[model samples]
Target: MTARTLHVDPSNAEQARSWDGEEGSYWAAHADDFDRALRAYQRPFLDAAALHRGERVLDIGCGSGLTSRAAARLTVGGPVLGVDLSGPMLRVARREAEREGLDSVRYEQVDAQTYPFPEASFDIAVSRMGVMFFADPVTAFRNIARALRPGGRVALLVWQGLERNEWFRSFATALAAGRDLPVPPPDEPGPFAMSDPGVVRDTLTAAGFDTPELTGLERPMTFGRDAERAYSFVSGMLAWMADDLDETGRARALANLRVDIEAHATPEGVRYASAVWVVTATRP
Candidate 1:
């Protein structure tokens, strides 16, 4: 497929992605890694989204189509569309769909921030750690609302805070290697962007949804069989650092994180607890 620049929510969306031509390929290559990570710790979030079967559902930022596949299994009469910006991820999803013979689930490569989905179409929209990448969440939620049936609902599972997520804190700390790397601002355009309850309510309301109910979303993040496994797991981010790191710097960074992982490791394996906000709102 040719690379094309397209508007997501509108000419001026708050949350948009260019993908840099790698979104698809990167996720496609690591589909199993992504799936395993999600399955071990994200069952609660998926369970909450798969509610009310026979109602059309949209899986936004549906990387590798895990939630999309789950959505299809949950709905017998209604169909589900999995939208993502990565072509490679969609390819993996297609193969998985074929393997499972999932006829009701369909996947598409498109920007979720501004895609022109029909108004009042979906019964529910579910996103698992996907909705936060939008540069402008207010616009993204509004666009999401455009695709929902009246009284439809939107549910999301997003990271709560950096301090609360040990895996990420350890990852960042180890990657820093004595140089003070600034933690992402709380209001930045990522998972922590939606951590605030006031902001969550404001964004949902601005996007045409009623006041949202925020449920505490927490789970154990089992990284690997051991600390070594945990170190290897985070190498995904290291691989995608988008910077030229000399061999020494890279090795040191990895070593530092490995030690941290070892410190946090348990007898059974590398388990880190993370927290997220399970936000739900109705489209009024």
Candidate 2:
């Protein structure tokens, strides 16, 4: 295999590795499943973006190009470029776009935090559960601000906190049963780094974006069609957390996770309460 070209921040080296390695590959393989799981947030995210015809769009961290394709449908006269750190996910995105005949959608493997996007190249920038992984969020948003035309808008969906999101809270506790999971440092690059509204506001303001309008919303995150399916899916997604465990420990974690999942099972499907911050801001 030829080595891939990387246009990422040195600080994001660890993330690039995880996303480009096993994590990215797993997501690529389960692209459709993951999309279905996150389907609830799509409409809310797009509604906030308010995309229009002929409007250029930038989809930051556009994994598997699902959101990118949705944006492309609105802006047929303009292009939708989805940039991500994972080459595997980008490939899956490209394949799906071609299969769907979405000619206006494209995916690029680039770090949105530091990518040299052309000035005033986009009318809107959006991310669905994508903007929170930045090692240097201020620089990332600053770069994004520079990419947009004056008055261009940005809308994103980020998780609120561990306590608020039942999906992570339940699974994490179950997965760490009988084991000690160290707490991550505050402001560390992870899913919940942007959870605090005050930090988000400060970061955006410093990044040259107007004060962001943050709306908190709660919705169900679909796990699977049933408890059995949900257990398998959830286990696979969180399997990395048990990498350090022995075989017995891994099995115990899965056992605990199954019980936790069973409690949330519904006739419609396995649903978990998820909380998010739907933030919108304008480039000024």
Candidate 3:
């Protein structure tokens, strides 16, 4: 596999913008699965955020507006703004909001890590597996904290270690032949970027938040009506992860993914069991 850049720096916006500009069509092709996976992983974090009626909310990296709309539905009278860097994703979000006649939900395409939002503008801020790609997490969390009123709740969901998470770890191990891959640097952005509870606490406290807490949960990442649909969904995921693989390696990665799907299929569908961190903190 060749070394390629990733969307680790939330500040750069270029990589994610590139991933979206270039990889968005690929992601869009699997929009349904993406939305489903997000929804399944989001329940605990949303409950942690405890959105109340008439309280404005901010959803970071609100791809396709699924979580934003869900938050709006939970809020009843509250307005929710979904922000993302992908134009196509934001467009989808906008279209979906309009189609649902959801006036209270809006989507904006912006560099979420550095965007200059009004101070203390939201009663709550929530993200479903979206807060970990910041190149400079300190700035990102501080900015997000500044956007929330003091004592306003901030809750986000993040994947745990690759080992604890089977779907991603399985794919990585299969494609890489169980070779030990270096985890993201303590401060570098990537999946599992916020996995460590101590780091999460320290980061949130440094960002002007208090008493950051992390709760763990497990969920089934179900896909498709059957194995075919399941395989289709996981193939796209393989593409995202195997972008650097050579032809032979890529081919093998895909084959391994198929094996994984077949092995994990349930009576209703194929579901990858996943572990997550539902982290919540109050802006102090």
Candidate 4:
């Protein structure tokens, strides 16, 4: 087999490895489940983009290509390109796109922070629960800006904050019943990295985007089909979190999490209140 070369940014090296390794595999394996959980964010994110017919689109961190497929359906006159850092996730994205017979949608396994797209090639860029993991947000956004035509727009959905998202906080607290899990720094390269609107606006402005519009949205996110299923899915997905614990400790954590999930169960599913920011910007 021929050797492959990657041109990922040094700042994103660790994330590229993690997303291209076990984490990516796990996400691909449970693609449908996670899709269901985050499905509520899709409509709002897309509405904010207001994609036009014939607009060339780019999807950043397009895990499993769900949003890419959606964009493809909207833009019949032009193709949609979805780029991500995870090989396994891209594999799943390709499979799903083929299964759905989405001819205009394409998937590329690349570090979007530095991918050299033809200048002014795209008319719009959209991300659903993506674009928040960049180690250098400004550099990444700037690189993306270079790919857009003049007046091109960007729409993204980002988690509002740790305290506002019960899905993560409840599960985290449950898992840490015995162990003290340190809170990650607010500026860490994680989901809530862009929670602060001021930082997001400043970063986009520095990256050549015009003043951004932010809208706070709250929605119900599904965890699973039922409480039992939710517990099984969540525990398995986060099993690694307790891998460092003793056997008894791991068992206890799982048991406590199970009870907590059960209490929040409804006929629809184990639902949680999630808050996010629907941010939109335009290149000058």
Candidate 5:
């Protein structure tokens, strides 16, 4: 969808720009790689949802529709709606759903934080590493809760602290190239926004959901089959890290990233430890 027709909260404007622009384009292009990287979390996250047949599903921030498609399959005969701010990723999601012949799945380009969803219409809401970037999470979640029926479930997979996520820590450190990068606040609108269990619990409670249950889950995230391929994938995803560096520093940073990624290479693939919280709650 074009910007003219896109609806988003004022607080989420910056995020909308990034997710709908180059960042979104890159993710859409490498959708398979991303899906594979996070494959280990799929079964567990979905399992937490405990979906039943004929249960309407709302997939928030459903990039590329991996989880949404899976939800559709699990809730056969039930309608599934996947919403996101990125038109490019939504396009990929739509195409994949069509290719899978999932007539029950539909996609929309809209911000989950402020989208006017049909009230009390959904049986469950799920997000895979997708709910943490909300500028106002409580408000975002409140919106989600309103869209759900009483007793409707909400399940989310969110990254743990950066220190516990080896993939991010190692990559960011290597990319820093000895330059100290400023850290965003723990509760900022980013990947680690919901990392703290206490914050997550509080947010959900304030948003009109039952106290959230945070379950710790650990897994190995695969970047690519080999170091070179992993480097290409990672560098593409985080090249902005080195954007302010000089020529020599940028080269050095890239070399450091390659070395670090190579250290994680295994016979099967380049993998690194990742910790996440599988948060579950019920709408009151």
Candidate 6:
């Protein structure tokens, strides 16, 4: 493992560990699959960014560098720095960038919550389904604000409430297999942390950003081309759900998951409805 350039915030230590360990490894190994799942949102999210030529970009929690690479192309020779806590994902990101000949794109393994970024160094900061895992969102956004030049913009695509997301609801329901699973509080550091528009607005405001514009976006996230493939992908990603189950219980959960996934399969692909908030704010 490469040494991190800066200390991770104590609140983000567990997140750092997970994203740098098994979870990160899974994401890295299935980089293409994960990217394909979220590909539907890329265009709209990038469109909202409105990247200009020669504009430097900072991509927070940039897993596998897909968004960074896309931003690099839009920047037209500008530098794009992608920072994340996952060493495995960063390696994949670097390899993908090199493969694409995006010399202006770079990846670094660092926790965005507390990384000592050069102040006012970037023209734009963006995150796609990222920024939600920050344990101390206000502090993290403040740090991000300090990294941006005056009038610099920040664009983020974050999940909406868990109930509105069919992908998560269906999966969790299937995997629970009659067991009651508690949902994390909406304000906690997780995918749904920023699901509330009110919290997002207040967080950015407290972090020295202009009032943010929150736009709701709905889309279908592709899991795979068929039920079998989708089951393999999703089960692998979410296998931890069955960790506490006995062998028979685990089998039952897996069966339930397969059935649920198969129900959603279509000729085009196995896709599930998803909702997100596309938020854009500027550092004053």
Candidate 3 residue pairs that clash = 9-135, 10-135
Candidate 1 lDDT, tens digit per residue, 1-284? 42455445453233333342554465577677656655654677766665666889999888888888877887864788998776667787888988988888888877777778988889999988787777778888899999998889987987787878877777777787666776777666765877778888888898889999888867767666677766776676455441456789878877787788887788867777778888888988
In candidate 3, what residue range of length 10 has the lowest lDDT sum? Answer: 1-10
lDDT of residue 119 for candidate 5: 98
Question: How many backbone clashes does every candidate have?
Answer: 10, 0, 2, 0, 0, 0
Error of 1 at 105 (Å): 0.8
**Runs in model 5 with CA error above 4 Å?**
none
Q: What's the lDDT of the predicted structure labeled candidate 2? A: 0.88
Candidates' lDDT values, in order?
0.75, 0.88, 0.76, 0.88, 0.93, 0.93
Superposition TM-score, candidate 2 onto the true structure: 0.96
TM-score of model number 3: 0.89
Regions more than 4 Å wrong, model 1: 2-20, 240-245
| Residue range with the least summed lDDT across 10 consecutive positions in model 2 | 1-10
Estimate, for each residue in 43-88, the C-alpha lDDT of model 4 and write its tens digit.
8788889988989999999999999989988876479999988888
Instruction: Select the stronger candidate by lDDT from 3 and 5.
Output: 5
Kindly give the stretch of ten consecutive residues in candidate 1 with the minimal lDDT sum.
11-20
Q: Give the TM-score of candidate 6.
A: 0.98
On lDDT, who's better, 1 or 6? 6
RMSD score of candidate 5 (Å): 0.9
Q: Return the candidate ranking by TM-score, descending.
A: 5, 6, 4, 2, 1, 3
lDDT, candidate 2, 15-74, per-residue tens: 888888888888898887788888888898889999999899999999999889989887
The sequence of per-residue lDDT tens digits that candidate 5 reaches over residues 184-273 is 578789989999999999999999999999999999999998999889999999999999999999999999999999899999899999
TM-score of each: 0.89, 0.96, 0.89, 0.96, 0.98, 0.98
Model 6, span 1-284: residue lDDT tens: 63343368878888888888889999999999999999999999999999999999999999999999999999997999999988999999999999999999988888888888999999999999889999999999999999999999999999999988999999999999999987868988889999999999999999999999999999999999899989999999999989999999999999999999999998889989999999999998
After superposition, the stretches of candidate 6 with alpha carbons farther than 4 Å from their true spots are: 2-6
lDDT of 4: 0.88
- lDDT of residue 13 for candidate 4: 82
Per-candidate alpha-carbon RMSD to the true structure:
2.6, 1.4, 4.0, 1.7, 0.9, 1.2
Q: What is the Å distance of residue 283 in model 6 from its true position?
A: 0.7
